[model samples]
Target: MTDDTETDSDSDSNPNQNESTDKQLISGWHGRYYEDFDVGDVYKHPFGRTVTETDNVWLTNVTMNLNPMHFNEAYAAETEFGERLVDGTFVIALAVGMSVIDVSVNATANLGYDNIRHHNPVFHGDTVFAESEVVSKRELESRDHVGIVETELRAYNQHGDLVLSLERTPMVLKRSHAEPSAAEPPGWPEGIGTQPEDC
Candidate 1:
């Protein structure tokens, strides 16, 4: 007796059935391995933050930006903006920080950013969200365990207007190949976990 059935090769393969190098992720880790990224993939970051007067002023003053347009509402009202402008560096940092869970949670280091541009002004009370798309990738020449991933990062305001855009490159460790942890994998040290004897 003989029976034949054709199976589609494009069907999803179960990791348990196949010999995959990827391992089950531990709890609290939410990042992709280098092998997971694909060109043209888009990740919409999961948070939106509203800029505040305090946020702008603190960031501006701490960074030594004495520009009145950022902290002085009265001075800004005299200008065409009609209100204080949110510092551009603060906005960029917030945008990129929101993307950490999706983009670089397991990354080694950020290489650099290029072609940074501000398209529209952000002011107090304006909410912003970020999205990134994979642009390109390459294996690092000097390193065999990591590859470089380039992405086009974009931030949009509540009204759907593009506020900023830039290209960021990060060094990512491959899922199949990564450098072994140096010490105890970056957790609690020796006697730190012990409860206080007095308590």
Candidate 2:
């Protein structure tokens, strides 16, 4: 029988130095170069965070939220489905943060979000994971170093069920020698749509 195991330079077999795999597990942005990302690309975030009852209660009260379903357990118990519920805003905020590493680590500003939906209720004990899919990439008309990128975020529970979805647009900096985009002109620029002022 022949042994075919191969050894790497950093492997434990090199006894001169003792090192652990901690460095390997350190999680952060992958820093994928500009040329690497493309439309339709999908990235799943690395970490799953477990929601706690304390988190929900704190967020609900601190935000001065008026939703009874989120805080008052007794009030919720009398409702259609009897249980304490997590705040919708908390779930959205947390889910967006969860996807930041894979979606916006190099972003300049969050342009805006569109079509946000809470597909299901997120419970206190449920664990959440996030994923993003690149929808489009367009060069800013006057900006040389940054481009607008649109992405869709989908948050799921540990059981592989989607609980929320939203689309966001952001300006992402390119890793190049070009100068950063200058601040947009003070007033609304041409060709941009506008809304009527409230009477």
**Which is the leading candidate under TM-score?**
1
In model 2, which residue pairs have backbone atoms overlapping below 3 Å? none
- lDDT, candidate 2, equals 0.76
Task: Go through the candidates in order and give each one's C-alpha lDDT.
Answer: 0.82, 0.76
User: Tens digit of lDDT per residue, candidate 1, span 1-199?
Assistant: 1222223332344435556665342334437768889999999998799999889889999999989999878999999989889999999999889877777866889999899999999989999999999999889779877888999999999999999999988898887664323221223353453233413
lDDT of 2 by residue, 1-199 (tens): 1233444534557775665643222223345434446999999978899999999999989999888898888999998768888888888899889877767766778999899998888888999999889998888779877788888999998898899999988787776832222221123353344322211
Candidate 1's error at 120, in angstroms?
0.6
Q: Which ten residues in a row have the lowest lDDT in candidate 1?
A: 1-10
Residue 70 lDDT (model 2): 86
Give me the candidate number with maximum lDDT: 1
Model 2 clashes, total count = 0
